[model samples]
Structure formats: structure tokens, C-alpha cells
Target: MGTLVSLGSFCLVRFAVRLLLLMFRGAEASTFTFVNKCGQTVWPGILSNAGSPALESTGFELPAASSRAFQPPTGWSGRFWARTGCSAAASGGAWSCATGDCGSGQVECNGAGAAPPATLAEFTLAPSSAGQDFYDVSLVDGYNLPMVVEASGTPGAGGSCAATGCVVDLNRMCPAELRVAEGGACRSACEAFGTPEFCCSGAYASPATCRPSTYSQMFKSACPKSYSYAFDDPTSTFTCAGGADYTITFCPGSAPSQKSSRDSSTSSTTTASSTYSGTGGGLTLEDDSWLASLATGDASHATTARGPVPFLYSFIAAMALAYTLLQ
Candidate 1:
């Protein structure tokens, strides 16, 4: 009887160990690291899909040259954007941002999403380790800043697993008609004209009908890898292997040495010299070795972003339960 009881206790402990491994594995599947390389502060806002659970923070302040990390569970889907020029209303009034405001009146966006004219990083993580994750940097709503999304993991079969983003500073060259004078954001043609064609609404909802407008063409010319219009899935969407972590960098790389231009009358293209004078002096768009270093676990920032406390606690608890059962 004693021997039988010992065997049963051992089996229970083994089962508990397996269960804890599965739980932690799911927790570590997706770690989002947001790096703010901009010269000014960036308040990043997150909005989870209807069926997804909220992360530890819906929004938070990320100062320049800093980064923050979050681990979302499997099957999570959400969109992320940065708010600029934020401040509190005098005398204990509502806090607000000049661009990409979630209108939650505070840093924590809660369930709110960013207002228009904000560059967005959208993601839908795989449900399991075997599935693929779909992600993209979208300017369909317009652009406020330069942003990039880089995935790090084992490449899945039939997946591109490439980095995609708008690294150029679009605000400097945005069409005068679409430029937001106060906040330096660039509005989409839909927001500027409010026409059904530009908005991809009414009769132009389908991909076949909603062709890219001249404005979207200009955006596409500048940021080819980004979503320039409503139906830009072909080039804008990117996929990675399951269990990959992503790093979203704002104001990535040095200022552009050249900018893209289009003449409406002649439909001609011209390139102009431009540069981004952000504070990220050591990083440049051309040199992506730093990103590769991150993937190989050579970057110091990558190690600091993930903590082992949760796993440690879980192991302790499981061992304690096993000990009690054995006794």
C-alpha cells in the first residue's frame, strides 16, 4: 500500500510539472518590446481585440532612448501606436496628446484606441506554437512618425518573416493639403477630402473597386513596405513563425539622406535630400546588424526585457505541492 501511494504521488508531481511548463510556454510565446528612439517622449497606446484580454498596461509613457517590454498570451490580437506632444490640462484637468490621442483623459488608454493620423503597428499572434503570426505597419489611417516592426524567431515554412515599417520621416514631405499644421501629422486622403473614393467606403469598399489614389501612391512610393491604403494587403502584410517576439522601434535609423516627391501635374517623381535628426545617434536604417544581434541574443537590452521571476515562482509552488503530496 505504501509503495502504491508513493507511485501515485510521483505521477501527480510529474503531471503538475508538465502543466506548469505548458502555462509558461504560452506566456513566453509573444514578447513585444517597444523601443523609443525618437528625440521626444512617446506614449504608446494598446487596444486588444474584443475577445482578447488586456495587457498589464493599456498605455504608458516611454521616454526617448528607452524601451519597455510586455508578454502577451497566445492567440492575442491588438494594435499599437504612439501619442506625441502629450500634456495635462492645467489645474488637474484631463491629460491629452497632440497626436494619436486615445481620448481616455489619462495615460492608460483603458479600452480606447488611437485617433486618426497615427501610424499603427497591428498584430495577430498565432493561437499555438505551430501557427503563423500576421503583422503590419499601416499608414492607411495616416502617419505621425517613423516606425518599424522586426520579428525574431525561427522562420516558419512558407513565411516571409521580414521586417516591415515606414522608416522615412513623411511629415517633412507630406502634401500641403494633408499636413496637420498644429501637430505635424499627415492625414490620409480620406480624412482630407472625405470622399467615398478616398475613404474606401460606399461603393468603393471592395479591393477591386478601391484602387490606390494619387495620395496613397505617394505614400506607397515612400514607404513601400507599409499599408498605404485600405486594400494594401499584398505588400503590407508580413508573417513570422509562431513563438516569435517582436520589437517595435519608433524613429528607427538616422534621418533620410533623401526623400521621395511626386508632381501632381506631370505625375513625375523627384527625390530630395532629407535627414531625421533624432537622438538615436548610434543606430541607422542601413545598418540592421543591431537588429540581428537582438535575434541572436547578443543585445543587452533583449536580456533585460524578459524577467525570470514568474517562472521561478511557478517552479517553487509546484515543488511545494509535490513535497506535500509525497509526505
Candidate 2:
């Protein structure tokens, strides 16, 4: 988990912070700057490794001049969106925004059978800072996920570090690695950003491959000898670049909380609730929920999951073979 400092729309956040500090001494005071990417804030709360807390959304409104987005607590996993100053009702859990991409005016978190929110690249956010009263969020999601671009002309070089499918690190951006290479997404930017006629199939990789609404973004300038690949933000971490002259880093609009053992545990152990809403617009959490309040992590972290996948595969294969020969 990372820290989400100031989100967009900071019209009244500075004032709110002043008021919050006056009340709760040492309260982290993480605020939601994004008012409405698409939906209104229904249930606002500050997410944390310990747990999310419903904020007093009596009067929280964001400024109309920010580009930061919302952020989940250190332990929670979700997406946040916003720009500049945010306006929200801390006590009332309401938000004021003209338009946002929060999904047809509905924003929620933590639930089963619930579709994962749109993927955000460079899930950017400004950590609580002095300059801005609210958080600032920016990310790289060509498709519902963050992205790093790489080019062939400068693989592992400047700008090329993030050409087409670069890996977005928590604190830094790097070349996105490929499980399978040599086509589609090149390991270099020179190859990725060249004319489409140079690519393997005369097509440049784009996120729109997944969503039609984003189809226009599919076409690239054209690559010399490069290809593009999409990486899943939740799991993938390494990236490769085709060229190596520059490293292009996509600055996020906001940042997540610092990663920690406890928070990692929560991500895996905690079950998705039936419903969970956000503030600013006062989203209602789901009732009849079954999500467990637990920590998550690798086996070494006390979280229990299936044992080593390789060992399981071997055993299953052996059993299958034995049964087959016997029959």
C-alpha cells in the first residue's frame, strides 16, 4: 500500500485540514481530492492498514483546478480519481463534481462479483504535502491499468525506460519485461513508436484492445522494430525497453501508502465485501457482507493459501498418470 496525499479539487481541503488538525492530534489526515470521475461520493472514509474509517463528510468540497485522484488505504486495493482542488462534505459524505470517469456515476469498493474498477496506470497521487491542500493524482492506464513505454532505439535508455509497456514501480518507473517477446510489444521504444507498417502485423499495441470506448487510443505513431505489451499492475513489476536513451516515467496523479508487511497481508487475506462506498458523495457500503477482516501476504507472512504451485502440479500430474496407466 502507498500513501495518497492531495487529490484534485482542493477548493476547501486546506481549510478542512486546518480544522482536522485542530481536532485530532497526529491524525494522518489523508483526504480524498477527487470528487467525481463518474459517480458522486456516497461514503467517504480514509483507508488504512488497520481499516477504513468513515469520515465526517459534513463539508468537504474539492477545488476545480486539481488533477489528483483518490487512493485506497495502505491495505485496501482500489482506484481513486480527481483533479486539483476537491470539494466534499466530511460529515455528510457528499461530493461536488461536474464529471468524472468513476463509471456511470457509481463508485464502490470491496465486494464479491463486483467488477474491478478501471485499471489505472502510474496510479499517481501527491502525498500529503505543503504546496497543495488536497491530493494530486496522475497515472498511466492506456487500458484499465498503469503503463510504461519502451522503444527499440533506446532500450533501457532515457524516455525508452517507459515507452509502450514499461513497468511502473511504486517509487520509480522501469522497462516492462515480457514473458514472451519478439512481436506485438517490442522491448525497445524505437521499435514500438515507429510506423505501424514496421510492426509484425502492421498494428501497434493499444489498450483499446480491451475496451472499445478507448479504441481511438489504439493507434501509435509507428515503431521502427518494436512492439508493445500490456502489464497487469497488481502482479507484474519488471519491464523492458527497446531503446536506452531516456527513461519515460509516467507521473501518477496521486500515490498510495507506503508498502508494509501488515498491509500486504490485508490485500490477500481480506475477503471482498458485498458492498463498500466512498465519501464525497456518500456511497453506501454493502450489507450482508462476508469479507473477513484479515491480513494477506506470501506463505511466510502467516497467510495460508495453496502450497507451492510447482509441487502441487507435479503431484497432480503423477496421480493423473498413475490413474491413466491403471485404467
Candidate 3:
């Protein structure tokens, strides 16, 4: 009986420790805050990678000057875009959106993807290689609203973080042939023409053959850090340490003032980050604070969330005591 009790206690202890570690393992989740400064209501949609589970809400209404936060599990790779001029039918039917419409019609995307002429914010969080989040604002699908993505808790002279986006409104300046005037969005030349050259497909597939066209150049000139075309990866994507949180703003050039609340100590600080401006189209190495956070691969939140840990520990203790008493 004594030996049985000892063995049981040892197993329980191991199980308890494993449970606790498992709870803390999720601390590295990244929070993305979406802010609507577009002077109108916008329905933001989220799409996770095919194999990854979707985040809490697939879509939600974000009023002007308002914001919402989403916590995605580590290694979540996805894209976010805004839907405009949307309306749902009172009876059970489809939803219709003027621009960036994800076909499902209702507010929630329900796995539906945004249509072309919609600005996009793409991210690969906690990537396998270096554990840094790679993100960018893309006009490759075309442009709807001005947008910016800023990283917090970064280090350096310019804050060691790079903020990237197409903050310029390309709708008004869009070439007449490519303008979707009713929706106030600009369609990409490829979306408008669907040509092999504009789409960067077939013979134009390779980067060597797929050079930026006149239309793509216009987008590149306005938003240098954005993926103006399909082959814009070399200059568009950016990285930050895994612990950093990101803020994506619509109409960023005229973004309104707003406050943010941090839920975890391991999360990035809400310090004011400088706007990133590319001069001479050069790049620099960011600091190591983010690197250190990424190096561990298991770096998690400083403040633990309220979970089943306490109850689990109590149960384990009670079970161990009962076993000892029987012995």
C-alpha cells in the first residue's frame, strides 16, 4: 500500500507539472488590434490559413474611430480586409457588399474571402524559421481604403520597428478605366484586365519575366512597402519579434486618436511608435529585444490568464492526500 501511494503521488506530480506547463505554453499568442478611421462603418473580416483554426470572430462591425482586438494562437497565418456598403437580408438569404465583399453577404465572412479591389493586411505570425511575424499591407488585389500596420514594444533609434502600409487613398486617383466608382474602390489592373502580363501568370510567371507594369508602379510609388503586384514580395513583407502586437488602421493618413489596453505582460508595450518612411529605399537590421523573445520559441505572456490551473492543482493535492491516507 505504501509503495502504491508513493507511485501514485509521483505520477500525479508529473501530471500536474505537465498541465501547468501546457497552460503557460500559449502565452506567446499575438494580439492584432484593428482600428477603423475611415469615417464610416467597416466590417472587418479574418481568414486563417487553410490548416489553422480560425480566430474567435470571423467578422465584426467596427464603427468609425473605434477598434477591436483579436488574439490568434501562435503560428497563425492569415489576412484581414474591410468590407464596405454591406447589408444583410432580414429573411434568410445572401449578403451583398459594395466592395471587399466576402460573398457570404452577412457581416461574418464564414470562410468567404474578400473580392478583388480590396486592400489587404496579411500576416504570418510566429513563422517556423526565425519565429518572427512577417506582415504587410498589400495593394496587389487593388486598393479600397488607406491603411497602416504598426508594431509596438519594438526597440531602436527609429524605435527598431517598421510600420508599413499604403496610407494613400488610391480610389480618387485611380486610373478611370480601373476605378470602381460606385464602391469608391480602385481595381487592380490585373483584376480589371485579367491579362497574362498583368496577372503575372503563364510566361510572365517568373520574377525575371514578370516586371512591374505601369499600373503596379503607380501603387508602388504611393505605398513603397506594400505588395503592389504579385511579385512584390522582396520589398513588401516585414518582420518583428514574436512578442510584439500589431495595430492595423484604416485611413491611416487621417487616423483618429485612440487608446489601447494591454491584457498580458508578455505582450508588446503600447508605446507610441514612429511612422515608417522609406528613404532611398534602404533597409536596416532591427534590435534584439524582439529577437530574444523569438529565440525561446516558447516565450509567453507575463501575466497568466485565469484558467483551470488552480482547480487542477487543488484536485491533484486532494487526490495525493487521499492516496496517502489510504496507505
Candidate 4:
């Protein structure tokens, strides 16, 4: 009789522990950290996708050499960009920015998206902790500044989980036809010409119809891991094990030791096809590994194998304890 009671108690305890573990894993929230390394202040803007809840802030000022962090609920999908050359309204005037303006007329974008010719870091976080998160830096809209997105603290298995972005300053070498008149941003061929080929619209909507143009090639050559055009998916889109925190940095290659200083000219462009390199803030571009996987079209083996190993160990230990109590 005593043995039966001990066995029942142990089973109940083990079941309760397993339930708690599952709940704890599902409740994990991902954190996004934004770092600004530019010489000038950058106003970062956020726009959540439809049906997704709003983040803590829609827009805020991030001074040079500063950083801020935000925690969004699970299953968040949104895009982030920086607005430069912003100005506060005078008297009855409206607040505005020279580039990547959301047209909200104030610091907070209030759920508005950034205008074209702005560098954008887009994300679609997984609905659950065990799923995969998709992210990419897109020049399909255009390029306004250099940015890099790095993921950390993600599960070690499934998905490449590599760092990606356009770290080079394309503004200095932007084609004359594509350069913004004020010279702060570079317009996409689509934004400039509005043709079916460049815009990938009309008959060129599908990947089979649309193809990369000279302009898109230039962007691709400079930033191979970033989305050079609307159809750029295979090499541009990156995935990581879910529950990973990301850091998006502006002016990633502008450190003192780098080719360009924030205050000086950023004419020298660093190509992503180069060897895996580390920029400022201890972040490295995992280009080689990602490219190798891209070449073989086997991204499944990119990440180290990791799963609920800790949980399994705990469960085994609990089972042993339960057996001893039953004995």
C-alpha cells in the first residue's frame, strides 16, 4: 500500500514538472537591440505587419554611438529603418526627416511605414519558440544608409542563423540616375523608372518572368546577402531557430579602424562576398558558411544540432528519483 502511494506521488510530480517546462519554453520572448554607430543622430522607425501587435515605440531618436533595446511579443512581424536629417516643426510647422520619413509629422511614426530609398531590416518572428524566424535586409525599396542585422541566443539547431545586411555605404557610389536629388538616399531602379522589368510588376511579377538588371546586380555585388530586388529570395532571406534576439546596427563598417569614418566620406564600399569579416561592435558576417550552404542548396545543415537536450536529461533524472521512491 505504501509503495503504491509513493508511485502515484512521484508520477504526479513528474507530470507537473514536464508541464512547467513546456510552458516556460513557450513563453520566451525575443529581444531586439538597435545600435547606432553613425556620426549623426538617426530616428529609427518601426511598422508592424497587419494583425501583429504594436511594439513599445513606433519611432524614437537614437544618438550616435548609442543603443536601445525592445521586447516584442511572440509572433511579431515588422520592419525597421532609420530616418536621417530630421527636423522638429517650428510653431505650426510639421516634423519631418530628409530620408526614410514615415510622413507622420512627428518623432513617433504611430504605425506608419518608411518611405522609399530607405534601408530596411525586416523580420517575421515565429509564432512559437520551437519554430524558425525569418529576416532580411532589403534594398528592394532602396538604400539610404549602411545597416547590419545579427542574430544571437538562438537555438543551435535548424536553420543557418547567420548574420546578414548591407554594411557598405552605397550612397557614395550610387548611380547618377538613381541618386536622390538631395544626395541622402539611393533610389531603386523600380522607384526611379517604374518599368515592368525594374519594378518587377505587370508581366514580370513572377520570378520566371522578372530578372536581375544592371542596377540590381550592382546592389547585389556590393551586398550579396541582402535583397537586391523584389525577386531576390534564395540568397537574401535568412532563417534562424526561433527565440533569437537580433541587433540591427547603422553604419556597421564605420569604425575607426574601418575604411570610412562616420564624419568623413564613405566612398569605399566593402563587398559582402569577401571573406567572413568582423565589423564594429564585435559582430561578424557569417558569409562563408552561408555561401557554402547556398551553393549546395542545403541550408538544413548550416546550424549546429541542438534541441531539448536539457529537458530530456532532467526528465531522466526525475524518472530515476521516482523509481527510487517507488522501491
Candidate 5:
């Protein structure tokens, strides 16, 4: 049974990655710098698209007021989100996070994606066909921390570039029903309700049907440039003019002179309880060597899958497929 599950995962992931590449062709090579400016430490998780190769390290520790830089090969499309209140895994040297846990029970998520109700910074760089990079800070999954993506430097030739993200901390204003992780993160209405209206499933899957709700509007009001809903691409998705490299910062207000209204209000913060915690070092590394083997050519890494995907991706993918077909 485990073998069958792994086989299915391999096929599904491979198909998904291929479709992503075709959808975002002309992607260019780029380097990303993930910086942690939050007052507390966070474990950052990385997950590439199904067919895409994995990054150098799937997960790692980023202490408060620190940063790390890594390069994703051309055509890579995936997400980066922080996990807070992590404790080291008992046997694997892995860290389990209170929020944004990837279910790998390790620092490296391997090929696994993040759990929902976590702020996500997503990227699709250098889409060859469009000749641009598309990126956005998404609150559609919900919010845990403040974040922003800045693209500096000139665009190549005729390309254009700009910065876009939700620099405001939404947790302070998150609706009571949508609050999760003891208010450390905000859960999207869809995640909380799981109905057709909130999840945009079944009949509500189409863009025309799944219009923005009052809750999404609240998020938009707080961060106009960020994605408040799944179909907010027209307003939320930003192009980097010429596929420029980017700096993704947690707590954008931590930067000089960027303090937002949310940052200034009261300013008292609380730490949530975590099931696990771990410092950096002495952890078992998941076997991600398959990434390099598959990177050499256009081939799928068809090994036995390790675990079922975290529920977040499965839900999002289903909704996305419904939206596409209904549209």
C-alpha cells in the first residue's frame, strides 16, 4: 500500500511540474535571499513544484535578524514560508513547527509543501514565454507574519520591475474565528469553513462564482498589494519587469523607516506554545539527492514517495483545477 501511494505521488507530482513549466515558460535563472527580521527565530521551509528540482536545502534555521541566500535553477517555481516555535525531532534531528509544519518531521521538507494558515512568498521567475517573473505575497492561505518582496536594479532591455507584498502584520486584525496557532497566525475563511463558498469548491470554483468575501476584503484593506483571495491575480500578481532577482523579507517593518500601522499599535506580542523545538545542527538530512539526478535532464524522480502531502497542497490544487475548468 505504501508503495502504491508513493507511485501515485510520483506520477501526480511529475505531471503537475510539467504543466507548471509549460504554463510559465521563458523562466530565467535567479537567486533569492530569504531574510528573517522577525523578533523571534523561524525555521524556513522550501518546496519546489512537483516536477521541478528541489533547492539545495529543503529547510534550515534562520535566527532572528539573520539571512541566507540560495539560487534556484532556472524554471523553478515554488514557495517559501517560515515555521515558528519549532522543536527538534526526537530521532531524526528534524524540527517540528507549531505553524507551517511540512509534516516531514525534519528541518528539510524534502519535496513536501507547507501546511496552511502560513504566510507564503511564492515565485515563478523568468517565464520564458512572457519574459517576466511573476510573484506575490499571498494571504490566501492565511497570515502568520508580515512580509515583502523587493526587486531592485534596472530591467534588462525593455523589461520593467517593481516591489509588491503585504508589509502589514495581519494577525493583529485577523477575525476571531479565523485566528489559529493561538493568534500567531490567521486562518483564511476557506481553511476554517471548508464550504463551497469559502473554499471555492464545486460551484464556487470559478472566478466569477468565487468572488471576494468580506473577510478577503479585510485582508485587502490591510495590504492592498497582497493576494487576499485565490483569484486576485489581476491586482495581486506583480511582474518584475525583467525577471529580476528578489529579496524576501519577513517583517518588512523591521527595515528602517518602514514601520506599518500594525507594527505601531500597542506593540505587545505573545509567544505561542509549540509541540516541538530544536536548534540548528545535528539533524538527519532527508535524501534530496534525487533533485540533482533529475536536474540533469527532463525526467521525473520516480522514487518511493516518503509520505502523503500535507493537506494544504491537495486542497489548493483541487480548487485550482476546478477554477481552471469552470473558467
Candidate 6:
């Protein structure tokens, strides 16, 4: 009788453990971590495997689990404007970033020829320019497609810009843009090769001037000064390489590419990085592995180890004691 009770207790305990495991399910998909070269996290623009990459949208979905994956050109250029300080009623959207104001902000949308502030997300296969006046770089449109990251300027209080007129700096705190001076001046960037200016009502902020052509032939002559990541040689900037488009995704400690400092005169690829920052805070991504480990895979042997089954043993002992007394 004693031996039978012991054996039954052991088997019952094992069954209970197995049942618990089945009820909880073993692991999950959160354990994996993926990186997108496209520079954006919402995958629809660059990572979606099913949608037409040539279309534009806010985000995308991954075809499968991947790590360090660049944003595949889905079509959206990964560019959107957040109205800066405008009430929803006034800006008509979240922020009037397209207009440059937050509330009651307005932009002087001149005729069809008015200039708009464009975010340089990627370059497409296009011809180069000879000067800084006008230039073009094919861009990756949403739907993972092609478009142009054109550059031009205007001379008005604020043409079609969100709030009158101003150029919003995208390259902030990254080692890249920091290589130049700050504030109302054409300190660094592809514009310096020409006349570092801001796109205000009549001239670029740096006193250089703005036009609506989109291409800056200024680099070839100014290539000696500052080169466009799209027009320059390979490894020009983080998102300026020649072949594929880059979508941006923000993650913790994931901003290794934020460095923008390089020596233009030396032409030496290896140069110290000058810290520069503009606005979109450094990329901070969530830990995917945390989710993945919980979804699948076997637990470590140490984890599977069974602790003393005190409750089970106690119950068995009680049963035995009752039997002895009754007998």
C-alpha cells in the first residue's frame, strides 16, 4: 500500500505539470529582433511583403521575421508632416508641419508653381546636375516605388510651406549634420556646396535662396565642399547609398548611423564623426526577443527543473495517515 501511494503521487504530479504547460503554451514570437535599413519602423512603406511597395502610407508589415532588415521600397517615401503647434481645427490635421505652424497657422499656397518643403527620404535612379540651382535624385515613393527628392527655393514670407515658409532640419543630433554650424545659417548639408540658405519668403534661411526646381547642381562645383548623399559616392550618408532605399525605424541605442561628420576635401572615407541633431529623436526600438522567447522554443533545462512537490507529498501523507488510522 505504501509503495502504491508513492508511485501514484509521482505520476499524478507529473501529469499536473504537463497540464500546466499545455495550458500556458510554451514560447512566443516576441523573442526576435529585426532591423530595417529603410529607416522607418512602420513596415508598409518599406517592409510589407504583400502590398505594392510603390504606394505611400504611414507604416508597413514584415513578410517574415528578420533582423537588421532595411526598408524595402514599398512606395511611400517615408515622409509625412506633423502640424507644429496648431489646433486640429486650424491645421486640419495633427500638426501643420506641412505649413510649419501648430494652430491657426496658415501657408501661402501660391499658384501651382508654389514651393513646398520636401523631406529627403531616398533617391531614385536619375540623372545628376551640374550646379546648385536645380538638381534631382529619384526617390522611393510609397508602395516601395520611385519618385524624386528634388531641391529648389523661393523668396516669399512662406510659399506653400506649412506656416508661411521655413526649412525643417531632419538631420539632428546624428553625427552627420552636427559637422556644421547651427541656427539661421547654411552651416552644413548638400546646400552648402551652393549657398547654404533657408527657404523663407525671398531667400533661403542661410541667405542662399530657395527655388522650386528640386535639383541642386551646386554639388558638382561644390562637391569639393559638401556632397549630396544621393549624388555622392557610395557610403555618402546613412540613407544616401546608391542601390536600395532606406526607411527609418526608431529603436533604443539603434542610432549608430546618426553620425554625419566627414571631411569633404580629403575624400578619405574614414573620418571622425561630428555629432549633429535636428528633431526626430534618436531611434528607440522595442525588444522583440522579449516576445519571441515567450512564444516558442524549449525552456532551458534549469527552467524545466521541478522543485520539491511539497503540496503533493503532503496530500499523499495525509491520505496515508488516514488509511493507517482507519485500518
TM-score for candidate 1: 0.77
User: Which sequence of candidate numbers ranks them by lDDT, best first?
Assistant: 1, 4, 3, 5, 6, 2
Candidate 6 lDDT for residue 277: 24
Q: Please give the distance, in angstroms, between residue 60's alpha carbon in candidate 6 and its true position after superposition.
A: 9.4
Candidate 6, lDDT over the whole model: 0.24
Tell me, by lDDT, which candidate is best: 1
> Cα miss at 244, model 5 (Å)?
1.5
How would the candidate models be sorted by TM-score, starting from the highest?
1, 4, 3, 5, 6, 2
Report how far off residue 87 is in candidate 4 (Å).
1.0
User: What TM-score does model 2 achieve against the real structure?
Assistant: 0.21
lDDT by residue (1-327, candidate 4, tens digit) is 989887798787777678667746743566687777776678999999999999989999987766777878889999999999899766768999989999999999998999998999999998877788999999999988878776664544657776677766677678899988366789999999999999989999999999999999999887878899999999988887777767777876432122112211122222222221211122233544443332233435333322233346655676677566656
For model 3, residues 1-327, the per-residue Cα lDDT tens digits are 989877886887676667655544544456788876555678998888798789998888887656778877878888999887777665866777778898876788888788988999998877331367778888989987767676653322222336677655567568888988463888998999999999999999989898899999988876677898998887677777665577787655332222222332233322222221211111111333322222222123111122222345655666576556545
Candidate 3 positional error at 38, Å: 1.8
Model 6 spans with C-alpha error above 4 angstroms: 1-53, 56-95, 98-119, 123-230, 237-247, 255-327
Q: Summing lDDT over every window of 10 consecutive residues in candidate 1, give the lowest-scoring window.
A: 256-265
TM-score of each: 0.77, 0.21, 0.71, 0.73, 0.66, 0.23
Per-residue lDDT of 261 in model 2: 18
Clashes of each: 1, 155, 3, 0, 18, 127
Tens digits of per-residue lDDT, candidate 1, 56-93, equal 99999987766777878888999999999899988888
Which lDDT values do the candidates have, in the order given?
A: 0.75, 0.23, 0.67, 0.74, 0.65, 0.24
Q: Which residue pairs overlap in candidate 3's backbone?
A: 27-301, 95-105, 266-302
- On TM-score, who's better, 1 or 4? 1
**lDDT for model 3, on a 0 to 1 scale?**
0.67
- Give the per-residue lDDT digits (tens) of candidate 6, residues 1-327: 999878876766666556555433311000111222222222222212232243232322322112232222212222222211122355365422222121222332111110112222322311111111111221110011111111111212211100010111223322333222222112223333333332123244322344322333322222211123333332122121121112222221222222111111122122121111223332222333311221121112101111232245545565565455444
**Candidate 5 accuracy as lDDT:** 0.65
